[model samples]
Target chain A: MGRSPMNREDTTKNRILAAAGPIFAQRGFQQATVREICDAADVNLASINYYFGDKQQLYIDSVILAREQRAQQFPFPSWSDDTLPEVKLRKFVGMLLKRVVVMQTIPWQVQLLMREILNPTEACRQLVEDYFRPIFDRLLRIVDELAEQPLTDLRRTQIGFSIIGQCLHYRFSAGVISLMVQEDQREECFDWDELTHHITEFSLAAIRNLGSHVAVKSSPRTSETH
Target chain B: MGRSPMNREDTTKNRILAAAGPIFAQRGFQQATVREICDAADVNLASINYYFGDKQQLYIDSVILAREQRAQQFPFPSWSDDTLPEVKLRKFVGMLLKRVVVMQTIPWQVQLLMREILNPTEACRQLVEDYFRPIFDRLLRIVDELAEQPLTDLRRTQIGFSIIGQCLHYRFSAGVISLMVQEDQREECFDWDELTHHITEFSLAAIRNLGSHVAVKSSPRTSETH
Candidate 1:
């Protein structure tokens, strides 16, 4: 009976976070209210303060939860010493595309995380070293293996961003693309399998070519600065 | 003084459209008010409709003006028949990256057009046929010239998007990127010249490889559909 009070507290906190994610995503932190979140969770007004300490803390927790849930759903596969970086890249893009798009109605948690990344709040400063840096580090390593010649740090970082930029474009530019592209054309590229395959092949082909071409182009002075 | 009335009317209309561009861009079509725009221009309340017909028409004109001003400032360079498509592509990307990112405080017009693309409104459907279609056609042609072999329409379209997507990401993902990339590393990729060079090289490499690699991977049935 004593432990049940603690269990109830846990349930209430979780419920508040569940309700807060969509509201924050929809309205943004500046506009979303604690009252609205409490209303959505069907909890007492005082429960949020008692559980998470404050609204900002609740928002940060919601962002973390969104990231954590996606991580579990599409957990990174273990790679052996023999696994090809190209293959790892394809798998990585596939997972990211799945998280970013594909679903008819995107899950709220995914939207919240995507929004956080787009206009990151104070939460991101704290989270990036822990979350984004490691993921970014993994991407850079994959790009490193794909390149045959030694890439300067800045050049390698650009390539990493180029691959990610392609994926992000599909998610953020849907409205623009829809107006520009024919419906049939949209289906062909936007299809989950087709997009993953295209991004992987495009990045691979570029990666294979970058070593010889860009090394001559990148100035030593600039590269050394970075 | 018969002509003075016509000139005054022209000035008022121009003033309203100029004022509306930033307001609509900042607040978006749904949130921005005609009252705010009138106040900004320091014109009477009735002057808006008298000049532009209605708020919707006013919003559309603001979008068109934004596109036109950027076009005039950064007019596409004319190419001779012998000019290589790769050169053309590089020039094209350079101009675009300039419009999208290089300006210190992105001119209000540029921001308005970008917002229109991301969450297109009634203005887009009308503008797409006249404005966007020609630009898109030019991009597809550039890719067509660069491709050594025949590409299916869907394939060509995807390639076009891949180039445009890379450019769009740099504009939209600045906050996320700033958090992930170090300040020193950012200058290497983000300096106007550096980004244009990287995108062109990356896209060209991918285009050169596409004929052999993607043709085999693209199913005949899917390619035939579009």
Candidate 2:
């Protein structure tokens, strides 16, 4: 009885979000209008106010929804305690590559997030706190297990960034890389699974050797001859 | 006496380029105007036509000049046969870091090149051929010296990109990283020297151990438990 109206309300909100996501993704916040979103959703203009309160809220929700949809589609597989850090790392890196980079089509959310990276707003700050912080924490946990012993937060963050940097490079430099790679090797170069393997193995080798055997000098910059 | 005309022409052209580079960097190619470039150069607007012939030629010359200046500044040391691969690798990576990432103020040339990245044109293609291809080849030579056996082009490229990816991540994600790093460790986090050291060591460890001891499997993707 009471739940019926609530479910209807939920449906309308979701419909508005689905319509608004791509519009907001394509056009920035100021440019994306409530009328367009309502028209796209096939609802009247009042529906935008009724469902989302305002256009700004609609934009924020769309960005959040974009992240949530991907998180749902490619959720991380649950790993037990006995799982090797190496295996955990491989899975984590592979999932990030898949979610962010390896997709056949660039998700509207990615474009939306790219917009945020350029012009960070309140939503971007919230995203950092809610979404990215958790992922960063997850990476730190995995890196902790790989350390020879308990490592400093800085070292852990560096190792995590190293792993992340490799993954992100593929996404950012895809254009330049395409131009640089020979035509014959382009197929292998773009294959997500092959790339994941390479990045994983490369990072694993670095992590395993880093703390145990790194030959630090008095000043690393001074050692450079060039 | 013939050289006098050439010298005068060179000085005026250099002046125009010096002014135009920053304006193009600040305002992208489409928006940047020849009049503004000339005004900043303290030369009449006609000087743009007289020195570079056209706006397009001026933009191209500015892009090329950006690359040339950096090349001259951080040119790789001529290593002797006796220099260890470790030392060579350190210097190569360090020089790259110095050139791209480790700077007090990002040279406008960097911003100008960044514009090329977003909207590539003739200048970008020339950049890849004349500037980047040679750097890539140099990286291959360093990696070759470190390898146990002669590596394939793909392998060498992957290795080189891994190093480059680590370096570039800092520049592209500077804002996100600033937000992410904790307050107490902020200084070290942003320190270019410290960053260069970490990246160089992490990469060297990976390169040294990668082919020699990377335990290969029949199917790497299938081996992940998660």
My TM-score estimates for the predictions, one after another, are 0.84, 0.81
Best by DockQ: 2
Q: Compared with the true structure, what per-residue lDDT tens digits does model 1 show for residues A1-226?
A: 6444553365777789879989987676767889999999999999899988998899888898888878778776557778889888887787778778736666787667766765568777766787667777888988888889888887888888888888878877776777777777767667877887888889998888766565557542322112
lDDT of 2 by residue, B30-77 (tens): 678888898998888898888678999999999988887778887876
DockQ of 1: 0.37
Q: Which residue pairs of candidate 1 clash?
A: none
**Candidate 2 lDDT, A1-226, residue by residue in tens:** 6344553464667788888888887666767788888888888889888767888888888888887777888787568899988888889988888877735566777768756654467788787887777888898899889877777777788888888888877776666777778888877786777777888888988887886786333464555644
Q: lDDT per residue, candidate 1, B14-93, as tens digits?
A: 78877899998767676788889999998989998887788888888889888888778877657889989988898778
